[model samples]
Target: MALTVPRLLAARAEAEPAHIAISQGADTLDLAAWQARTQAIAAGLRAAGIRPGERVGLLYGPRDWIAYACSYTGVLAAGAVAVPMSVRSAPAELAYMLEHCDARALVYGPAAKPPDVPVELCWGPERISALPEAEPIPGPRPGDAAQILYTSGTTGRPKGVVAAHANLTHGARLNPPLRALAHSRHFLHAFPIGTNAAQTMLFNALTAHAGMLATARFVPEHFARLIERHAVGTVFVVPAMAIELLRSGALERHDVSSVALFGSTAAALPPTVAAELAAAMPHATLVNYYTSTEAAPTQTSMVFHPARPAALGRAAAGGTLRVCDEAGRPCPAGVVGEVWMRGAGIPRSYLDDPETTRHVFRGGWTRMGDVGYLDAAGYLFLVDREGDVIKSGADKVSTIAVEAALHEHPEIVQAAVLGLPDPVLGMTPVAVLVATRELRLAEVRAFLAARLAGHEQPSRIVHVDELPRNAGGKVVKHRLRELFDAAPDPRT
Candidate 1:
């Protein structure tokens, strides 16, 4: 049978009726119960006037196990597209999304209130008394819009990237070696379900017959305790959480041997950080995927190859990747250019943003605005984001490359590099570092001198206890620039 999200759940319900399907601390639900709850929620959504092709926004906390799965399946079962909005989204931003998507209904939890929409439903652990188990709707075609994920809005206001059912399902079928070896029976997710990583995790788990463990937020101590308490086999984490787990010594204290697969996304995984995690959790395989929210996940590195830290592995299943110049022609191997992807798994367009959609989803190929190159062996090497490139004295330096170099130093725990306004150079690269131990600017400069060209080195280095990061592990460069502007100049 062709695999669809709801169909996968239904098959699991019959095949593994008694098997655990989801767990959160002390709470657990088997496949039978999970399917029933999802069906009931689907009926409720249909009753609430949700129709096929209409957008339904889900603004809820992470830990409500029943609601989380039911909400996702409910939208699909009702034949409506699910738009999972983060609980952390500002009210204005939420309002704009609701208006932009023309969302017909909203399902929210206690933490997030629905915007002024005609239909709103509140859900929690308590089962809805009136909801009935509804029949699953006919499976959607491959090209139907399955989800609309919002980007970080780094360049401008966020645009909703519309992903088709085929785009999501294709990735779901290709079982990565890490997940397969771990026998990932339980998926522990700390990231928000609204994001691409969370969505991918849920889809993959359901298809693999794995239970999902949800958490409201990431608290190092709490997360470690939960991992130990529940024999969670798979965990989806970000770089910030990985750094904290290493720094807090939580991994040493917790018995997380059941955690066999450790996957990271949304940011670059520094080689130093990956090494630390490998040392701490010798039983687990560390995997990192590099992709934008716009294109879904393009490439993934399931194993650490020290010689190729920048490679995002080969293209994911059903996808083709090409690094092309501004004219859309493929560049030579080892040369940097914008990454382009074409496949059944690529998104159709951006919701309600025709101009942006036309620019990105041009002629069936999704243009990922990241500048990167492919090696001779077919491994992808990401240089930096197109917008984040720093131009210094006729040279364009990748901020990510400089940050990755800084992170390799033993004393530096985390690093973020950004462009600073410079009169002499169009923009100069400045490194902001979070030090694990005492570090000096001179020592940092000397360390980079050997690894990087003179122009790629940062003109100034600042040490801070921590760098600002969003929930997805991406450095908020906008906030970093603001902080830099607010600081009193040491030169003065």
Candidate 2:
């Protein structure tokens, strides 16, 4: 069995040389071709004076997924840590990540516009491919740091989450090896190259029997068309894409009946939206995956069930899940608390922030920073992020609950709940949504009256064409607060 990425590539190349490993549009790399590319890149990096254990920044666009994947594996093959970065990020953000990791070199694609970072070496795909192929120094081990993936940084600056080779491979070393979505022949995902979710897809390409397919970027129409064109059997999406697919009526226009396994990740899929997706793709099995950058490879997955729409599944991949109080003691069943996950893989930590590392990675468990509860049957149900809970007057309102309630309304396609300042009630819940048509505040409230309490209901409603999201498709709630600030205060 392959214990590291380099070994995994060699094994796959030897076993399935001509099998397509990854594809993007007309570009496809077979296992043998991918291995050759990585070998050339690894030799090139070594010839460029990049030493073992050095960090190398991989800057690429979404369309540059093939190059980025080669760079990542090649860096590992050369016994260096790969810091995956997105060209979509601002120059300053990219520079910060490169400097944070003390990158020794940078590998960029043709389309990727990298910032002015002072690294020892900067090479593009053409330069790396031109290098003579040679064997790389074998030194990277299962416990060695493999990659540094930055968090979405919705609340603050992005923090790099460092993962070891073992953490990334999960159970690749085991006998009868545990592969990702082994049942399918092809899986499709539109996640950007820099995110943890996208990294998981890359791993799937290396380990799974399925060929991985990605878009140049995520366009709802293009996304649906790819599924139909490729007859993609397993498809992965974030909640935002799922909502857009439903909103744009893309699935209706395309024949997506070939999708047998539909997976949603990055955030909790709203139950109402999940139900709608199930109806649209009746042939596919809908699964929701819940995990954070810090607690990766260890996640909870729930198959959509009408009876338990809110449950986020139980601990998966032999991981432990707990809801703990302020002091870190596990809360009893049905009580809301901070969610934490612990898997067999090595615990990941922040790159430079020791304070945050200590706070988030404690005793082999990564604090998920989510407030949720576990039922008697061990199913997990998230209420809200610990910071997102609205403290209105003496009551606390879950933004997730209010958003879920808002989604139930046929007129609303997407909704985000946030707290805006109120003189009388500390902070009041406000709903910013994308609706099919103009909706009266009275009708929305009348609809929510049966579903939510007085404090839980939004004090005001703001209609928008779309919700502000980071590249990973997570709703940036802080941006939503700005919308409330611009509008005049409305009566509740």
Candidate 3:
């Protein structure tokens, strides 16, 4: 049934040897070719003394996506846990992840800089390709550990999420497979390697009917041109990329009508941006995919409907969703609470932190760390991150709701709301904006007045060229707070 990734590759290679599995610009790999590379890499790892169940770090840049994909598969085939790391990560961060996972070896690509962390061995594309292809190694069970993915360290050091083979292959073996973008011959995305969103794209390449086409980096004009050039049927992006695509007028310049499905993931899509996307790709289904590194493969996806612009969508992918109170009891419809999800796949945990593991993954449900509410129809609407909620005087404000309101303003190109320490109010909501032109605080306040409650409105405003974002396109709120720290007190 191909329950594990290795088994899936073997099955697909045998079933459709000539089928194109993935491509990056001029580089393409058929199922058979990819399988051969995977086997050779696995043989090399075995020869390097990388044992089963040990962690092996994969360092690769965006342009080396194909090599990274094959290397990751090879690690699994050799029964070793794959640790995917991005070259974009800070050297210290990369070193920490490799050292934390106790990696046996590091496999790197030409464009990647291997971390200085001590490991038994390091192999690059040249050496990896030189290894003789051996027959497939055995003994990887579906229940065994598969990969370790690190979360963006917005608040603290990045934590590794350990996903088992079952988690990655959850729905791969269904009698009637559920293929994403089933109508498309090719799906295109510029997601950075090592992100949860990018991991999903990898799985789609292995299981979906379409070929996965990826760009080395995301340039709005280039992205749009690729869609038009290939007549791409399915597309994916984060909200930041979508914003750029619209702001750069790429949609107007390029013929992107070939795209039938447009998906956004990694963060909640602001209602304003979703509306703009719907307007630009009128025929395409605009979907928002909401999930975390901890609750992956189990997510909720919504097709953009003008009537329910804020809904994240009901649970999909054989998973269940609920909004629960502090004690973990389910909240009634429309009541804001912590969000949690339970998927058919095995529950993931923090790599080595049992205390945090107990706090986040409870009773088979992964706490999403975001505050949200479920509607009567079960659609979820995010309020704010648990840490980002603003406590102003006796009232609480949702940063997400405030940001959504700010995005609707015509002059605002980007907006991030965060709590700033206030002498009188303890903490107050502040708006950091990237605007088309200078806007008076009074004018911005008046604009948000009708959209937000008094307490939800920002007490002060700050202007920036752009909001600082992580690789996955999520705003780094702490960095925004740092900006306010360097400035004169707003209360003054």
Q: Report the C-alpha lDDT of model 2 over 1-492, residue by residue, as the tens digit.
A: 327778778877887799888898799989887888888788878878888889999988888888788888999998899999876688999999999899999989988887997999999877876877666467588888899998898999999999988788777743345566776778999998888899989988888889899887788899999888888899999988898899899999999999999999988888999999999999999999999989998999999999998789998988999999999999999998999999877889888789989999998899999999999998999999989999999999999999999989988989999998889999999999899998877889999999999889888888999898887888889988888777776573
Q: Candidate 1 versus the native: TM-score? A: 0.90
The alpha-carbon lDDT assigned to residue 209 of candidate 3 equals 85
> What is each predicted model's overall lDDT from 0 to 1?
0.75, 0.88, 0.89
Superposition TM-score, candidate 2 onto the true structure: 0.97
Best by lDDT: 3
Runs of candidate 1 with Cα error greater than 4 angstroms are 1-3, 116-129, 137-139, 171-182, 436-440, 463-465
For candidate 3, lDDT tens digit of each residue in 1-492?
438898888888888899888999799989998899898888878878988999999988998888998999999999999999877789999999999999988999999988788998888878987888788878489999999999988888999999999999987764335565678989999988888888999988988888999998999999999999999999999988888898889999999999999999988999989999999999899999999999988999999999999889989988999999988899999999999999877989999999999999988899999999999999999988998898899998899889999989988888889988777889888889989998877899999989998888887788999788776778888888777777565457
Task: Give each model a TM-score.
Answer: 0.90, 0.97, 0.97
C-alpha positional error of residue 16 in candidate 3 after TM-score superposition, expressed in Å: 1.1
Model 1, residue 61: distance off in Å is 0.9
Ranking by lDDT: 3, 2, 1
